[model samples]
Target: MAFPMQAGPGENGVDLPSTARMHDYWLGGSHHTEGDRAFADHLAMVGPLIPYLVRTQRALLRRIVRYLLGQGVRQFVDIGSGLPTCGQVHEVAEGSDPPARVLYVDNDPEVAADGEDLLAGNDNAAFLALDFREPDRVLSDPAATRLLDPQQPVALLALAALQMIPDSDDPAGVVAGYLRAMCPGSYLALTHSGPDPQLAYACEMFDQMKFGPRHALYLRDPVAVQLFFTGLELVPPGIVPLPLWHPDPERDPTLQNPGQVPVHVGVGRKPGFVD
Candidate 1:
């Protein structure tokens, strides 16, 4: 059976719920549509703790970006970068002593549009519409190359977005391809929903969602998540729950219960020279 036609801005068919938009709503962003809000509300009903988990993931992204900046990484390629909400990559990176340059990539046109508007005056940031599964497309984009120095270390953010890349898309290969293209000393900070016992029931709920099969969530175990960083050297406290991966008490007082997030995160560095 064919899924109902889904439409985005300017499309005539019924407006479909977008994962990016729904995620924006979860993060208290203003870019989501009514349909996105409805879906988010439904998600809350089924997985009451989902919003909190989302918040935790977002906070973790901030911490990771800060850590990358401290490591002297000033270029970032944010694949699957969703709607530009508060505390976005550029905001976090550029806020550092030496600002960082970032390329925000997302497949959703609406998200691309919003990102463009949000990054309008920031010369350090650029938004491009590209499916993250196509690592070559992301790396080869003219804008990405223009803004980021290939010889310098870079940070590739794959947070919370990999779970949406179904197994058939060769998620592992896609990640490896990105790592291969990045210069040595580049870092990949990734987070994903996992098959935690506490959230097993949420998986079933997500399966029943009407957002279309392509947007369905694919939960992986810790081993599978770690596989994405195969050749790269994982940072300390490797592949642990979101809060447990270098949780900063100053940034988030909720570190008291790292397990409450119900997701896994890790940072891996492409091995070799970095300048």
Candidate 2:
């Protein structure tokens, strides 16, 4: 399903395939272009487990949000949030008593636009177009200030998003910036692609394929991913493979073979607060 290399702009003058849209395509969402499908298909052909990996990450997100809700964290800031689809934070959060306040952030203009449209009538959620690397901008944005209270605990989610950030951009520092703005009881729920042989080959293929700008994945080892949670207390079962993190048999029946997925996930709580 290779798309011919055509030299023309796509919708919204996007000449390159978008990673967000590719993710949407992987998750069986309709908000994707032919280019996105082509690129996603190419990677899936290389890794074979990519579709499963994507779904596993999504499942992990659902479980993480549920866990956060249980912890009484009512505000959520989902950085690098892609197209709002199934199992989105707002959907899962709003299902609980006293619907959680959510602020979705993404640098992609198209994704941000779609999110704005999706959340138009919903007062509990809002979308902000900003790069996660710019934590100050994300935290200072009116949407964040309005939806999330700085004095209260917040669940900051970076799921499957940090791998897109390269080392040169100071990924750990970026995490620190966001945590610095959060209250002591706040938590960071993160999932990053691990540095495995198969994933390395897939990344190589992705780079060779040249899907688009900022699409190159930076795989990190478990130790490296752990650094993202530097000062926080890792919740029990720290930094494990996707399927191993708080698996709910009833909800995630299809998830099998724990410790097999190359994506690392965990939730770390900021210290210095009680209740």
Question: Which structure among the candidates has the greatest TM-score?
Answer: 2
Candidate 1 per-residue lDDT over residues 1-275, each given as its tens digit: 00111243223212666666776777788877898788667767767777777777778888898888988899998887876676788887766767789998877776688788888988888999888888898888998888988888888898877877779998989888887887999999888877666466765656676534433567887899989998899999999988887788888865778767667888999999855
- Where does candidate 1 clash, by residue pair? none
Name the weakest run of 10 consecutive residues (lDDT summed) in model 2: 1-10
State the weakest 10-residue window (summed lDDT) of model 1.
Answer: 1-10
lDDT of 2 by residue, 76-95 (tens): 98987877776789988878
What TM-score would every model get versus the actual structure?
0.88, 0.89
Task: For model 1, state the Cα shift of residue 42 in Å.
Answer: 1.9
TM-score of decoy 2: 0.89
- lDDT of candidate 1 at residue 46, scale 0 to 100: 67
lDDT of 1: 0.77
Query: Which stretches in model 1 have alpha-carbon errors above 4 Å?
Result: 1-16, 203-214
